[model samples]
Target: MPIDNNYTVKRIPPSDVDLYKELRLEGLKDTPEAFGASYRDESTNARSYYYTLLENHDVFGVYRNTDTLVGIAALALSPKEKLKHKGTLWGMYIKPEARGNELAKQLVLQIIKIAKETTEEILLTVVASNVSAITLYKKLGFIEYGTEPRALKIEDRYYDEVLMRLPLT
Candidate 1:
């Protein structure tokens, strides 16, 4: 499906921390395996922690015409000199209802646009079991570089992740 024309994609500023946090927690709860962070760990964080995330990370959000935030993606640039040319793409989530509308693609394209200005490459990891997400990343030109076995253990089960990277330069 094509992206909804009414949906607007923009960089989420720190002043909108409450909205971003709400959408983030929803993502963590809805699909725990898709994200690296667990709901248990994030739910305990204070408002300041979320605000700090906005301060340090470049977060982009997709909002519906009705003023509801439906999707989010974040880009984190490496501060160290050795890794300054690389950045990590994380915290990408789109509401279930918002899926299939290309909002995820739009969000990612926006992140990539912003990332190109500062980094030569962007890296991300998707759960091996999540074929849809992996497919999406590949469609956006992210190539798999490696895989990490048992990357995450939730309770008794383990999940593997496929590491992928897209070079901008």
Candidate 2:
């Protein structure tokens, strides 16, 4: 089913490593390739690897009925000091059954809150085919920054990626 205001959004803790791995793998396995990594790549990472992401920075998930993880969004620091003012926003997903409820907007709202508190701006790359995601980001004040042509090669075919940014000024 779908949850409205009753559902809550909370920061993911290291204890829920398995659940995090499961949902993230599901995102990677989505038919349109929702993420930069793949299921095969995740299959190689150690269990503790995912735990590190939840533990290292503040990544959160929006859950329904206190158990159903229907949506997720993350903001993590950049690896370079010069880019410290910038953060990467990614790992956004809403279960198929959870669509049409403005959940993605709420999730991004949470992410943007954190981004404002932690970084100057957020940068994200959405697969060009993901109209819904691009539209949501734009609605949240993201502007087109650039594009990556043929960014992904999946199944012998190439796909372009659109880079978008939200300046928290």
Give a tens-digit lDDT track for model 1, residues 1-169: 1245689898888888999999999999998988999999999999999999888889989988836789999999988999999999999999999899788889999999999999999999999998988999999999999999999988899999999999999
Q: Taking the tens digit of each residue's C-alpha lDDT, what string does model 2 give over 22-108?
A: 888887888545678778888789999989989997778878877767677788797788989999888887888887888888778
RMSD of each: 2.1, 2.4
The local distance difference test score of each candidate is: 0.91, 0.83
Model 1: how far residue 101 lies from native, Å: 0.7
Off by over 4 Å in 1: 1-4
Q: Best by TM-score, which number? A: 1
Q: Evaluated with lDDT, which candidate comes out highest? A: 1
- Model 2 clash pairs? none
Please identify model 2 stretches exceeding 4 Å from their true place: 1-5
For candidate 2, the TM-score is 0.92
lDDT score for residue 100 of model 2: 80
